[model samples]
Target: MLSEESSTSKENIGLTSSETSTKPRSNLMASVELTGFADNGAGTISATLGNKANKDIAKTVITQERTTDGVWTCKIDGSQAAKYKEKFNPTGCVKK
Candidate 1:
């Protein structure tokens, strides 16, 4: 016969094991777009990732130019050159 304390400990251990086993791996992706304009005539944009751990994984820049008609055109530079290295857990696999 199992004591009440032993039974409770077994239940706790089982719950913890199940919780850890059921945790899904992270599926992360990131994208950036120009969202607004700055006071210095520069475009203000933001880059974000699905995982907070990847927020600072890359550097970005915005470029703006004035046309002959006094119109400003904004674009995202360094975007195409950005690279992402995806990481997988347990085995610590890295995919580029």
Candidate 2:
């Protein structure tokens, strides 16, 4: 009787292990973009990703330049933008 009980307990433990399947949480990558240009230079941008897993994981890649005349100028790949439509804010220079 003792041997049979031990064998049954081992089989039950094996069944329980196969029925459980959990996934581990992975590290996610996110970014935060901010700039001094928004809405065709009609506003200033101060955006954030807000409360991420880590501060270093959140990145900011702004591509805008402010002039002495209070004008916001943007450039992409060292070229002028006629109608910028990228992921970053300010959307290049908006030459139109």
Give the Å shift of residue 86 in candidate 1: 18
Expressed as tens digits, the lDDT of each residue in 3-93 for candidate 2 is 1232422222221112231111222212222332323434232222213434432332223465546786554331222332344335344
Give the number of the best model, judged by TM-score: 1
Question: What is residue 44's positional error in candidate 2, in angstroms?
Answer: 11
TM-score (C-alpha, index-matched) for candidate 1: 0.24
In model 1, the Cα lDDT at residue 71 comes to 72
**Could you give the C-alpha RMSD of every candidate to the true structure, in order shown?**
20.2, 22.8
The whole-model lDDT of each prediction reads 0.33, 0.31
Q: Candidate 1, residues 1-96: lDDT per residue as tens digits? A: 111232322222231123324221323324333322323333333333343334434333333444444576444333333453333111422221
lDDT against true structure, model 1: 0.33
Q: After aligning candidate 1 to the native by TM-score, how far in Å is the CA of 87 from where it should be?
A: 22
